[model samples]
Target: MIRRRTLLGAAALAALATGAFAQDDKTKVGFIYVGPVGDGGWSYEHNQGRLAVEEHFGDKVETVYQESVPEGADAERVMTQMALSGADLIFTTSFGYMDPTMNVAAKFPDVKFEHATGYKTAENVSNYSARFYEGRAVQGLIAGRMTKSNKIGYIASFPIPEVIRGINAAYLAAKKVNPDVEFNVVWAFTWFDPAKEADAAKALIEQGADVVLQHTDSTAPQAAAAEAGNVITFGQASDMGEYAPMPRVSSIIDNWAPYYIDRVQAVMDGTWESKSTWDGIAPGMVEIGEISDAVPADVKAEALALKDAIASGETHPFTGPINKQDGSAWLVEGETADDGTLAGMDFYVEGLSGDIPN
Candidate 1:
């Protein structure tokens, strides 16, 4: 009896030691998402990056995430809870979460924070975004050339620089290829509302738009276009290949795996630092999904060439001889737009109608 009790006590001590080691070995990483992972777009792509971190690190890291988190005070609450729950690193995947992330990071200086599509940063916070406009340029070219009605529709999310840049890039590229191209812009305010997005697409289609591009997340636009039976669409943020060949001719894929893994590794190695990262096609941060055979052979070839040129630094989407919507010259002849201007882009290029909502 005495021997059995001693053995049981020894086993208990061994188990406790093992549990402690396992706990210490794990680096807890948390993610705050603005939409559900199954939204099939922005948040979905971001979640893919989170999954990549888990796969890359395996047992060395533990990850937690909260989906459909609103970007205001709720975001702050979620982030604070994550930090208090022992999160070593937290990624707030939304532009509107910038302030909340900052507020939470200030209280927990030891915890690292990464805010997506936002410009603010702090001692413990960093910002990162993809130059989606590059992909939009390619989509614009396709939309311009393929439209039968000479009207292209853009479903914009917010009136921020990111969405605005996408609009201008697509418009300029489309207008370049098809001089008769006219763009109709619709602001849908919400990023992931399918009902609003679908209604916006329907309204554009009714207005004679045959080619539709979206800066918002969700497959509703694609569904609306597909249901209409003659419209062409491009995927946003994710491949969304389920609707390929017709409506979804191509896509702007956000590849966050490499960045996510690198950052998580930095945390593990004590090399993590607060910095801003903006990367695009050249670095494989933004990828143009496969162009379907539905596009005219010549158009597809030209689009591929343009993509290669952009990737090779031989072409800048916002090249000179461009003007603001008010007819003021924005870029002089042969002058390409600089990063500073692009980062804070607000005005639309000449020939685009309507005012940016305040």
Candidate 2:
């Protein structure tokens, strides 16, 4: 464990970035990104956010990144290394890094730790996540309107709360669009395995799926959609337009730069505090990429309108009559998912077939 004050003073990242940070030397931020910058999806977008930290604050902030670090043991190792390298604030960018982030946080009580998509909290560790599920709901509506097979294929990574929430949101929105729609989920169980993700996409296609969605962190699934012909796809983390351009109907984008910059700036200004954050469209955490022209004009108009309403705090996707997979009521009619249910969403909906083995 390394001291946050020690790291900030010892590291020269901020001093070099701009004179804004050189005035006080208060924050040294380090990020543990879960994927390669070239992966063109989840991890890539996050790294871009890290870059934004340097761009905006200049020398007022310091940012160091460890790319392609897997979420388990590798995550712990990276956190330790970053701590040793003198980091004041550390951001662990994946759900699997929860325990590791906590373990390291315990050793370095002075350093601030922020874990994404993880639900643990500590005196020094706070959790944060983007409402990607909300954006997925929009994608689902489009998928329902576009799909001809009535079968939407989903490429799932792990059955964590984050993944489950997205699946349910997508399903709920699709049901609203077309009640006959059914989602066939193929669990790849790996967050960013390109080959396995591609295989899952192909499997769903072979099983008569016409529209493909993914919770995995690769472009391979979208590529498979293109190869299968006439299948529709959506971007997961970043704009995956390079893959099956025409088939990729739209995307659930991650624009995390603004939040990252704000957090870093706060730390530099000595106003940083530990608090959980679950920012959604209201705060611009959830974003949409360019919709392909292949989609009909009417569908595009509807999607944009829905997106605007959600951003303006006029709508919510989790309003219920919502029930668990067992059909046990979770939320009453008009009741929405507070942060608790969404954070602890560990099961699939009734129509979803796979078991969420705890």
Candidate 3:
């Protein structure tokens, strides 16, 4: 009887050891979102990437996330907790989380961090963003051609370089297509406020804007446009296609799965390094969604051609003969804007009214 008990005890110990080893072998990834995963826009797309990671790695990886995390002290706290909880890699998916991501990364030197739509980097942190302005150019062309009022509405988020670049790119393309086109920008200042976004869209529509573009997340703008009728919109950050063929025509879909999978693989291979990645349609980072049947066949053809040109490097969205809002020559004819200027873009291009908020 004593001999049999000893053998059973040995078997139990061995099983426990194997279980612990299995748990330790899995690479754990963390994500901090600024909005709920079901927002059907930015965070939703990010969550899709996370799901993709899980699906790809199977039992080799573990993923965790905290949705709707505010981008200040709360974000830092979440990052710290995730790090403490054995997160090998954490992706902070919002521009506002930049400073907080840096702060948390300093304390957890072993853990890798990735920030989206930000420009900061450190030894343990990397930054990445899509060239969304490329998509905006296509949207602008469609808007210019589709709008009866010749007045386009833009629902802007914060006045960051990313937002500013989008507004400029859209305006430039629209103005090129329709010389009489005008842009009415309403700054919502928040990334995913449904009510605020809806209000902004309504106000624009009321002000004679027959078309709307947004840099903010959430499908509220699309819904608002649908309700307003005769107003068209483009999906922001994700394909909010439920309102398609009318209010929501085309979209700029953020495809983060490839990047996320690559980064996580780096962690598992012990080859993770900090670097910035800014890719657009060419590399499949930013995708232009389907142009709906509502768009005229000619305009749709032109938009697709523009997409192909941008992807093939045959077109630069900020091609020259452009001026700053103050009427200063920013780019001479045939002189495309450099990466430096576009990265740190702050001022509005010529023909855009009102000042960028402080």
Mind giving the per-residue lDDT tens digits that candidate 2 earns over 38-73? 888988988889888888878767777766666666
TM-score of 1: 0.93
lDDT of each: 0.91, 0.82, 0.91
TM-score pick, better of 2 and 3:
3
Candidate 3: how large is its RMSD? 9.4
Per-residue accuracy of model 1 over 155-219 as CA lDDT, tens digit each: 99899999999999999999999999999999999999999999999999999999999988999
Instruction: Give the poorly placed runs of model 1, Cα more than 4 Å off.
Output: 1-23
lDDT of 3: 0.91
Q: Candidate 2: where is the Cα deviation over 4 Å?
A: 1-26
What would the per-residue lDDT of candidate 3 be over residues 1-358, giving only the tens digit for each residue? 4564444434433433443333476898989899889999999999999999999999999988878777676678777777777789999999999999999999999999999999999999999999999999999999989989999999999999999999999999999999999999999989989999999999999999999999889999899999999999999999998989888889999999999999999999999999999999999999999999999899999999999999999999999999999999999999999988898999999999999997
- What's the lDDT of the predicted structure labeled candidate 1? 0.91
